[model samples]
Target: MRDFSCFSENGVQVADAASSSNASITTSSSKIGQNLVTCVYQCRLRNFSSFIITITWTKNLMGQGVSVQIDDSTNQCLCKVEIKPWLFTKRRGVKNVEVGSKLIDIHWDLASAKFGVSPEPLEGFYFAIVVNQDLILMLGDMVKDAKNKIDASGFAPNVVFVSKKEHIFGKKAYSTRGQFCGKGKVHDIMIECDLMGTNDPCLLIRIDGKTLMQVKHLRWKFRGNFTILVDGLPVEVYWDVHNWLFGKLMGEAIFLFQTCLSAEKMWASQSILEPSWSGSLHRDPHTQGLGFSLVLCAWKNE
Candidate 1:
């Protein structure tokens, strides 16, 4: 791993990694280095696979930056840039919620699957963790901080609504369940998923729900492939493309969209405004990057 403590000319730290797993990069301070603005350094591994570096630090401002680049296929070492945050003692009372609550209740499971089940109202929902602990903790902290802001602001901030749905493929049958928002106004959705638990990153999709479509792990910016469906049948059409980007820390992303590919055949060719959304946090901004945190919030459409 490369140490960018000195090379960051713009207060932005830059590090080059030869090859490392679960790489832990740290800064000299608790807050991101002064006037530090950092972005992911485009990188390439081998000749075909693109490598995006992930940085885990106390705050998103500095420390780690992840970037994806089209294959240059010639460079020996990849440069991953980051800015170091000011390292400070963690505030007290920052504790992990015990693993007492079920990660996903049966109701949520059914709903996420979009299976035909009775709607059981749930106050909140949780998705299993996929990313590193530091990232998760950072997400929890950011959500908590955002909640604190909501409570203190006194003015009613438009709550972003999120609903969970799932699709299942077994040896014999396939089915979907939950409050799916397929054809409606765009809403913010956070999905937690694993593609066969292989960690093979895949885009997530949903069909037959009240919520439109959602993408995961888009802490930066992204444009999605357009697909549509009708009664679980493809219409072979594409709609106006939607774009999702997060400049903030987004906890473990649910990037397993299996239905988006299947939905393209159902829609008529028409230009529609793509849904624009943003998140409040970035990759990981936990107290000390311990990476232990959970998120739950209420949602309301504007």
Candidate 2:
């Protein structure tokens, strides 16, 4: 747990200095550039039993950026840290902050981090946290390098990966990579929906090029959920495509996959939800919700 209150002096910027080497992910038309991916984790702190951390990776015509937000059990934001995509001088640094009279340090090294199509790094990087001089959490695959940056006596922090949300853009087919289980195998997710001129549009979802589920007459079945098996575990899939067919131009469809159903027993009640798609009021009772949700906001490009 790094301190975020003093984000100015201990290295702020995180972008690479190689202007020409760093690439922009935007295409010729700018409609497909404003996309971001977010990964949520539930970290149990020494004091609070329920603490949430959200890591958002953003990229566009400008460059790549990273933002971290921490919330306690009451859903109150404790601290936030944002690293800009320009001025790569501060790519690797540390920040210390005081919360509840305890000192916390956050260290990160993204200088040599390898990035894929998204702004998040695939490997060769690490983000570490130390609370009261004790190591609490560590992210990325570089374990040995990260441990070297933390105190030797501190052990690993208790952490659980909760959910993920990402905005995907495509004309008729949307694609993304998702890992359903914890540190599970990453699978290529493809969603195909062609409602161009047909009266009865269809929806199809695939994993690794193999069709897993398909929905016909999507107008009536625009909002619903079903169960499917992936890697021998039951996965609940819910979809809301009401906008993609008739809402507005370039409307996006919402798809959620509650993989593993390991969250809570209350989530099973969402199926018989009286007011469907009204997830607004669901904040209070299900603060962190029940399962590991994979939310995909699929945007269609005209």
Candidate 3:
């Protein structure tokens, strides 16, 4: 695990993860060009054991694909299933993976999946993870079809949405959808930064078409955070645009929208650092009411 440094600025505590060679937050130009969305969930397996499941959707030159990985509480990868990108074949299949002594069945049907501009499916799909005839985790809109195919009972699986990481690209403005809390309203998030031919650029953030936060002199305050109210809850927005302002041509910026309830207390306590999207699932932020985090790796389209 990497360490994080926290400091106070204008009465708001800023937690920054230390730079590391293997940091997943930094996305290269080649990877930034690919559309990817990774969602993490905390689920209970057999014997009430907790596990973290990561589902990543990808779309590139080849085609669209999805990968599912399950990790135990100790951060050890239990099993992983990758559906490689296919050009013409039906985008669906089933894979049975052996984890320890248990046989985990992974089922996905995207033959009729609907997608917008993102790689993730908007609907008309079903992804299910079954352990011992019990559905551990399920996604997409075709729940009935999934149950019938798996021959499982009709019951909602107990799972907590942990975090989501996505790559967004644009020349000066980037937009995406986000849900801050469980069962909360999904809002449209827009980030605008006009740096072309400007010495001092300003950063603007809007939620649901409403301007919520703005930062001027972005070159000077390239790395900072602010808090805003959404759905009657406080959401802390952290951004690090050092790369966008001074890094290489293809460098990308990072923006994190965190909906932790006790954010201020967590910052004051400094017990646990903000973990990376790929490596933070084991901590189970949902237990502490830390809420969900949406990480956006914003890239400039050249």
Which structure among the candidates has the greatest lDDT? 3
Among all windows of 10 consecutive residues in model 1, the one with the lowest summed lDDT is 102-111
Pick the winner on lDDT between candidates 2 and 3. Answer: 3
Off by over 4 Å in 3: 1-34, 264-287
Candidate 1 residue-wise lDDT, 62-159, digit = tens: 32212211111243333322222122322212222222221211000111121111121122321111111212111122334334322122222221
lDDT of each: 0.23, 0.67, 0.72
| Clashing residue pairs for model 3 | none
Cα displacement (Å) at residue 216, model 3: 0.9
lDDT of 1: 0.23
Off by over 4 Å in 1: 1-176, 179-200, 206-221, 230-246, 251-302
Task: Assess candidate 1 and give its TM-score to the true structure.
Answer: 0.18
lDDT of 2 by residue, 1-302 (tens): 11212112331212122222222222343233236888877776666565677888888766777888777777888788887534456778887878896566778888888876567778888887666775656788888877777663456777777778788887777777777765666766777878877998888776666556767778877766655566655677667888887688777788887664552254454442333453431223125436567878888777
How high is the lDDT of residue 291 in model 2? 51
**What lDDT score goes with residue 75 in model 3?**
73
The true-versus-predicted C-alpha distance at residue 211 of model 1, in Å, is: 18
TM-score of each: 0.18, 0.78, 0.82
